[model samples]
Target: MVSHGFSAIRYETEVKTNGLSSVLMAKCQGCHQKFKFETSPQLLNNRNKSKHYDVNVRAVWGSMATRGGLAHLNESLATLNSPGMSQQTYTTIEQEIGNMWGEVVEEDLLKAGAEERKIAMEKGQFHEGVPCITVICDGGGVKEHTNIHTMRLEGYANSKGTLPTQHVCYKNWDESSQAMESNIILEGFLKAET
Candidate 1:
């Protein structure tokens, strides 16, 4: 797989040289939003630097981070390192991978929820033309026994099964306020039309 990826990138570089390099358009795995980035054929061929400078390489990095978790990324990077590779290069790649993982792509998720709700309404699964939904809100301490606690809200449509329409997390300073936060989240969801 790695060899094929390298060959594909090499082929693209060789075939396209109108402006000295190729501009690779990468998309987010979650939101499917395209982002443009440029990379040179020389950079791709260089053995001293990490190939992550290339947009294709960055997409692979993001996919790996999203699918296999960070441990796998760390292991892969360890093998890719050469004696000439600088620490800064590895740091940059790791940072990019971390950023990819950190993105929740909430916009895409919200769109999906809206579509699901529309389908459910058409099917007449809702109660009295109103959506039959579940508002699950909870708050608990962090790390099991830790004092830090946070309230979270998730809305589930009956037709949507386990999928949630929205998921929100709210910080809490005191355990007593947790119930209030949960109530607020539930009330807000209940008031909103599906």
Candidate 2:
């Protein structure tokens, strides 16, 4: 007679993680079988040719949305008894995000400039054979003695009531807050000339 044997097999599990993503790996002691499971998909970073977990990028993005940094993210993770990312990893992700934003900002500025020029051309607003768009400058700073200042330049639609103002330039000033407006205006005009 043939007899079937029943036995309980043991498996060892290990977790590997990056940021909010984790991978569960298991190995069967008897059969030596291995299995792996991922909590998040890995994404490719085009600029650096590196791979990153999707959740890791999302976590950094969420931190940036709240204007927080690595410390803040770590604090939140610590409360949940989760491991925090290394500073080097955080910096790499932050730099990648910053680079992406820089490209977007440049594209937006170019589009805004193009739209302003088109509006000026349609209205026949020309000076010395160059299309001249009306630009409105505004600046503000803290009420206190802080020297920090911010300025924005908007392309005004003027007589065209249907068209809204388009932002052309935004800049931060390190000089006296009171004097920032004039400086920013001058800088805006200089930039337009080029």
Candidate 3:
């Protein structure tokens, strides 16, 4: 006789691309709406991650402050690093500081938000929320070990129409080839969607 171990796994997925697909339903439920559309892919890989760049921006700033040419900039930066600076003033100072520290590159955080908005526009999710298509997968029985896996949508259907979006992301996996599935880390979209 074989004993089956009890197991449960959970994970959240995001619409990386935010685009929609045409889920035509000439017949849905008890109605014949004959609806047609261009749906967006519903998965992490498809979801666009422009906002993530802001994180990079911060990391870059921190790293720059501690390294080479920009190393000395830290002292100057400390003066303006108070917690009481007005939001507006802090932003201006931060950007200036970033530039003065290194290449400066892009400054305004609002501008960064705009960049994310642009990507959301392409996916039609900038305004309207994307719908999630769910599939109950029967994962094999779990024993002393747990495995993680990410599922990417190759195609999708929605109200607009169908189109292919190029993107990929880590959805779920066994956590770095370890049976330690108890400690799951969802840094970004890896987070559970509400």
Candidate 4:
């Protein structure tokens, strides 16, 4: 016997009459029986007719991903939805349940990121007058506001213009870990030639 999961159900006429009572209807996997369950109005509204999962919101999320790290995603989104920008309507930033960001969007973003990195690398390359690309590597540690120690290695290339070409970072949990991370970054830079 195949145990298929419950299929989604749509309520047609009773939506307004029931205060949108029933959110889901599903068929049992084992017995193949159908059932409907009452859910919270919030859940029903958010799941059935969510403004958060629309295309424009998704496009904004993609924009946020390109701007920086995930830590800043919500902050940037909130700023975008501030009073001045409220008329634009980018308020909903919640991830949909069981929904994945599709590969088409992901692939497009990945390609764009790769292109940006390539352009930055090209910009870092030495132009005329300088015989060779001046490769500079440095590593250091910083104590963050959260009191966590983080170590990072920065690589720069100079010709006519000086630009950072690479960055590697890791948590410095202990002295030994910090040493190991620094050595790894140093080795990586040494292995790469401009």
Candidate 5:
């Protein structure tokens, strides 16, 4: 009788790239067993139920943090002889970052409002059973008042030693920038009323 230890061995490799990181998947031809080797860890993207390479997210984040956009990122990648992501992928990541920023800003605003309310209550700063707080409004232009582009409103307790908290911000482009300050301030006050 003759015994054969193994019949044959064959394998195939597939590479998946996400920005700078890659996953190399190897499969056995005979047994169809697959194994994945990753160059970097993956992050779970809760918005789309997808996994993103950590390096990809980091690259996008670094670009945004420095006020750079997709073009700049691509330029840098090109300089390094690396393939860059498509515009669609950059936009998707940008949108995700914007959503996360909005959530964080909202949470901070709520906490600040609660703190202001507490301070007002402690200082007996109430009118007709309603808490009374003071708000500061500011507006700035790119160069002149005619070029006004952004407006900000902040709220603080009436008592001294209380820090101000940002409540609302508006960026105007459609209407005349001159009137943006008044309009945004009014809107901020109206929102605070509720």
Candidate 6:
């Protein structure tokens, strides 16, 4: 029998990976509404990008201070109404709940994550949460263009719901474990070839 909390998100998103910036479309599970966006680190670092943009990739995604579990971090904002959450104890939460705020069960999320990682590993998708860096080269199998760009965004199902602060994190990649393995994590973001 399925657990009481076993609920699946009924939503769809359009992830268009063919532009100067990636287009993010999140469908709300609760409201069945569509949310659209186009955010990038370059745009985030752009001072002009602010004042009008609600996202700052550099601030939330591309800094030493921005290392680790970005998806998990973003997931927290969904439950900001709660109390007693801190970065220092992030690992603790990651281990106990593993992004309950992200609208996924621990075990189900584990499998989905594994599927993503496997696909990335097999097809050079770069690991999830890796920083996307862009560089311009002059020669030697290089060109005068940026070489990387990685972005992370959390989508909602539109339905108003509650999320837990608890989480689960794995120190290393162990198929036997249900937490985020070390190999699955990188200190930076994933670079997009340009």
In candidate 3, stretches whose alpha carbon ends up further than 4 angstroms from where it belongs are: 1-64, 67-108, 127-194
Candidate 5 residue lDDT tens string, 80-157: 998797766665676677678889988998898889889999999998897778765454532222211112112223
Candidate 4 minimal-lDDT segment of 10 residues: 145-154
Name the regions of candidate 4 deviating beyond 4 angstroms: 1-47, 53-59, 67-94, 97-100, 103-194
lDDT digits (tens) for residues 29-92 of candidate 2:
5566778888889999888898888888888888766756677888999999988977767767
Candidates arranged by lDDT, highest first = 2, 5, 1, 4, 6, 3
The prediction achieving the highest lDDT against the true structure is 2
Best by TM-score: 2
- Candidate 2 runs further than 4 Å off: 1-11, 27-32, 140-173, 176-185
The TM-scores of all predictions, comma-separated, are 0.30, 0.68, 0.16, 0.18, 0.62, 0.18
Per-residue alpha-carbon lDDT of candidate 6 for residues 47-118, written as tens digits (9 for 90 to 100):
233221223322233322334453444455446642222443333223223233344555675686567667
- Which is better, 1 or 5, measured by lDDT? 5
Q: Which stretch of 10 consecutive residues in model 5 shows the poorest summed lDDT?
A: 146-155
Per-residue lDDT of model 3, residues 1-194, tens digit only: 12255222222222222111223323233332344432332222122321222322343345334432122333444566611222232233344444454433334544654566676666666324643322232333323221111121322323336543432222344344333233322232245343
Better of 1 and 3 by lDDT: 1
* Candidate 4: residue pairs that collide: none
Listed per model in order, the count of residue pairs whose N, CA or C atoms clash below 3 Å is 0, 0, 40, 0, 0, 41
Off by over 4 Å in 1: 1-52, 55-81, 84-87, 97-104, 125-130, 133-194
- Model 3 lDDT on a 0 to 1 scale: 0.34
Candidate lDDT scores, in order, read 0.45, 0.69, 0.34, 0.40, 0.66, 0.37
RMSD of 2: 13.5
Worst 10 residues of 6 by lDDT: 146-155
